[model samples]
Target: MSTTPHPPRHEPEPGAPRDLVGVGIGPFNLSLAALAHPIPGLDTVFYEQRPRFDWHPGLLIDGTRLQVPFLADLVTLADPTSPWTFLNYLKTRDRLFPFYFAERFHIQRAEYDAYCRWVSENLPRLRFRHRVDAVRWNPGRNLFEVDHTRLGPDGEARATGRTHTRAVVLGIGTEPHVPDPLRPLVDAPDVPALHAADYLTHRDTLLAAGHVTVVGSGQSGAEVLLDLLRHRPPGRERLHWIGRTPAFAPMEYSKLGLEHFTPDYTRYFHALPEPVRDRLLAAQWQLHKGIGADTLAAVHDELYRRTLHGGWPDAHLVPGVRVRTAGRNGGRIELHLEHVQQGTRSRLTTDAVVLATGYRQRPLDRILADLDPHLRRDSRGRPRIDARHRLVLDPAISATGCAVHVQNAETHTHGVGAPDLGLAAWRSASILNTLTGREVYRLPGRTAFTTFGLDQLHPHPHPCPQTPPARHPRELTPLADGT
Candidate 1:
């Protein structure tokens, strides 16, 4: 036997054009990298500005579990036998037996983060601390140029480089959002107000405050409130939870309800009229934004337990309330609130505030600005994303066999599952299939039992209209469904 080491397959030399270049190293892109590793002829690289892989580090509170099952990992849904599966990570750590005995379907968020970090450490061609600056399509070269900055350990730019690729995938994730009324306070370092994304960082300061107010009724808000409740004294707990929602509703997690995250639903959603899609997205907030039933139950049980002494805890949980404005009052925060139903207004004075207003998709225009002129948009001025997750670009770019794909940025076109973990593997698989121009990962023909539309009663792909109705620049094109 010859004793020789083989070079990595499809490993491009420095400055050589690559098959794919991924902009962000989030879980979605990590999934794509893992699935692509087994392929023989695909040269892929992923970049992330962070020093290492971390998924919601501040919100990974103790006892908080993932909403999805363990099967919704980086590669299991697409290829269970892949060595990068979460189960394989457990096996490598000699914890598979313990995990099996524990019978945990949903793992803790911290554990999931550790698992992803493990994968990031082991995976090849994943460049951390590298920030992608811009992406431009070089028509003459028939390649996309990716400019990136390599940062030092302290996050200062140390070096700059560029790479050329046939295609690019962007997985730039969401950022924490603060309501306009509370943005000024959150931005002030002196004020104790902050978004829940930084909860753990300022947790001790928040607990030390005499009064703490959590704004929002979503899962993060509930989780923060529950954590605060558990730490504070029951009788002296000065807490307030307020939001615009009517009530702290439980998330829609029924068996049939989850089918909306399936690929079948994604295709159905993509084929709908643009106006209908927008309305559906607005109406389906509860599907993804509501609190988990168990989390809500724990909150209520904690509150109820404190009431055993015949006096209610000094915690106020109010809904249907909106914060009209906020300001500082003698080192304390004052929130001007309004009750929507009663048309009543009130003032709340608290020492600290936690804005759990959730996150919004990071805009792609910054990186893709160079190619913006060649990109097509929908009636709402958003990029037109096809069913396969590729941005619909001008023929000048597409004719050259170059494409720009997106992950987690297609909620409007792909439905709420765009940011969902359960759909991560499937979406990665779909993108891979499209990029390779072959059925690399044979996906399921039917993933949901519920037929989304009258025309979709039979399990077959629907034919999307090639051209939309003509309309003026400021008007909407009417559809048959009257959207």
Candidate 2:
């Protein structure tokens, strides 16, 4: 004789259930997001403050290709078999054959960003336009209670119900960093001082005025200045490119130099001591610094051409110069520059000033504010990160059994490769491994940053493109060798 069993009841409203929560949805956590998507019964939700995926959009200058190789794409570094690799994107567009024949080492930014969006749309786990407000440890359940505010349908603000998670990964990226001297002029009316990110939207106005002054020596400054000089009507405006460095810094991209961008190198870098790591970052900044070969060459060509057709307001390269002060002078920006090489100071009246200084990590204080007493800090007041990339909190939060893991935001405590594309896969996999408590460590020698061997996956082959090969300038050493 068999006994009858009752059917399980379901919720009538069908509301959201509690499980795992990911704080930020940048590329780092997105990589983990793709990994977590297929796991069985793993209810995971990721929150992104931005409405969509945008990586370095402001400086996606025309013909500006990626600094790293195609192998460093999102899924490629984590799962070679994944459908979202750069090679796979090319294949989907039927450009694989042409891409291989073209023999290009780098992929274009437009395509890279597009590919990331495609992956994001398919993930279905990401909650867009949502900002995490706070994370609290629930003592009774021993789980992470997360509170976030997300935009409801029709763009109106709605307070969504909270969810619980065993772990959380924070991958909030960096922001444009401005200097102290020009802080007041950030958005001043009529004065026109802005970061390079606003260059595209503000370009036409600045070009129409007359003189333009660009600050910083990194990729954005170089490219913005180059664009202004080459694109502005023949003799209308003067361009001033100033930098604190004695010379324009060329990005080091030799075969061995590029090893630092590889996972093998990042693992080795993370194993070093704190002081040694500091010394290494200072030494390698030059290797990882500044503009791409193609942009640098374009700047050189335009400069030379303009010199031949010389006149007033042609273009000026002021190296070893720093902006000491800036103010609005008769509806224009009057910048005081200290010519470091000559030990002399000079003034330049320009239509606009752009600060292209680099970005810094987004502080975790905003989201982690409520849990201040429970949070832990490292020797330098930085978040102490463990091998699994979990934040080492006070008392290690053992009684609660909750862990706060981070994704590639460990640069302050770890090293440079923390936020890079090279380690996306490895970091995601490690976090998963920790969450599952499984001994599966797929990527060899994994650290808080960098993953190895996923780019070499043989399962998915590159698809060919249908379009004709892209037209490039004369084959040059800078674009190829980059030495």
Candidate 3:
């Protein structure tokens, strides 16, 4: 390993068991850390393998904005007064007045990334460059053992450490998902095919290509196509955008329709039978998978602008098409495609391909392998996450009061809101409340005007207790003022 010294480390006291230990330091876990900071005695820490925080660095296009509003920041939705809010970051940076004048409800992606980085830099109880290797319930000690490796600047393991905690949270987040048919092309270094996750890294090479193909109709694909169309000459813009959907649909953004992302919906979804939940997930793609209306309009406007000169642009935007297979055609790429509705097959040759196919939850088996035997899986063999976000473990593990929770890894148990930023603060607060076994965050009684199910006619709102029960030594520290 290189001799470069590691950055400053923030770790819990040695030999003493912590109340909570978070496995991954993504936005979800970062939110948890921020919410846990003000509490006086909740000893907790988070770990991330990355050297620092970066939220979709490659897709931080110059003008792209977050899908949610600015209030849905790391801590604002949960506790607006928290010093770690996005507005606080702006105030500290001396940009609050300018932000007010800008009248922007949704901020740019880069600004959001900067806000998160500021939180990561100043937030206590965070350990970057620490890769968690395994998690197991140490029955002898009645605690969970978290084995992690501290890495040098170059990502080489420099030291190994074990942390003992009463509870563990896994927030490893997602990974880019490439379709099987196109995986070979994307994996081969010789081919120019790449996932949209690395769009900016090889953007110049793509712009120089004679022709480019974007293979997904989601928001990312739309953004990439719009960027390319704006850069290329009008009427000569040779681009192709295709997906399996019947049409490039806009996201469900109606006031009431958006309630699908509410906590009520999550509870209702969890109560659903496994098969019903699977079917609902399949039919609710537009709720979370479609392109944003503004993005769709921008694409249309750009294409329309190019046609004003009397000649149509040489761009083809097709749907209901899927790539059956892809291969290297000499120096170029050849894609074998089939149209489901039309029952037709064709071949297209392109100089470059951008797979905008989205992401999937990073599997937890690798890190939780040791605890697999204790985990209670669903009919589909996925971990069974309860309504409180805790993994349903064996009676032996539960009897010890040791719990394992997950973030952004419970769509099947929760709902589409599982991966949404708007729900991050709520989920984090919920996890904290569950871990402490008392109402620490004081969650909202009702978040949506629409009742998710008929059974909730008079939903008994179990808002966290105004005053936490007389705190036991093992209980967590509740927010004092109950703000």
Against the true structure, what is each candidate's TM-score? 0.93, 0.83, 0.93
lDDT of 3 by residue, 69-180 (tens): 9998988888887888898888788899999999999999999999899889988778999999999888889899999999999999999999999999999999999999
* Whole-model Cα lDDT of every candidate shown, in order: 0.91, 0.72, 0.89
Off by over 4 Å in 2: 1-19, 152-156, 308-313, 396-401, 439-441, 446-483
Q: What tens digits encode model 2's per-residue C-alpha lDDT throughout 239-318? A: 78889888887888666566565555654565566677667777766765656777788888876676666664467787
What count of clashes does model 1 give?
0
**Model 1 TM-score relative to the real fold:** 0.93
What is the total number of backbone clashes in candidate 2?
A: 10
Ranked candidates (TM-score, high to low): 1, 3, 2
lDDT of 2 at 248: 87
| Candidate 3 residue spans exceeding 4 A from truth | 1-12, 459-483
RMSD of each: 5.7, 10.9, 7.6
Error of 3 at 477 (Å): 42
Worst lDDT 10-window in candidate 2: 1-10
The TM-score leader among the candidates is 1
**lDDT at residue 8 of model 1 (Cα atoms):** 48
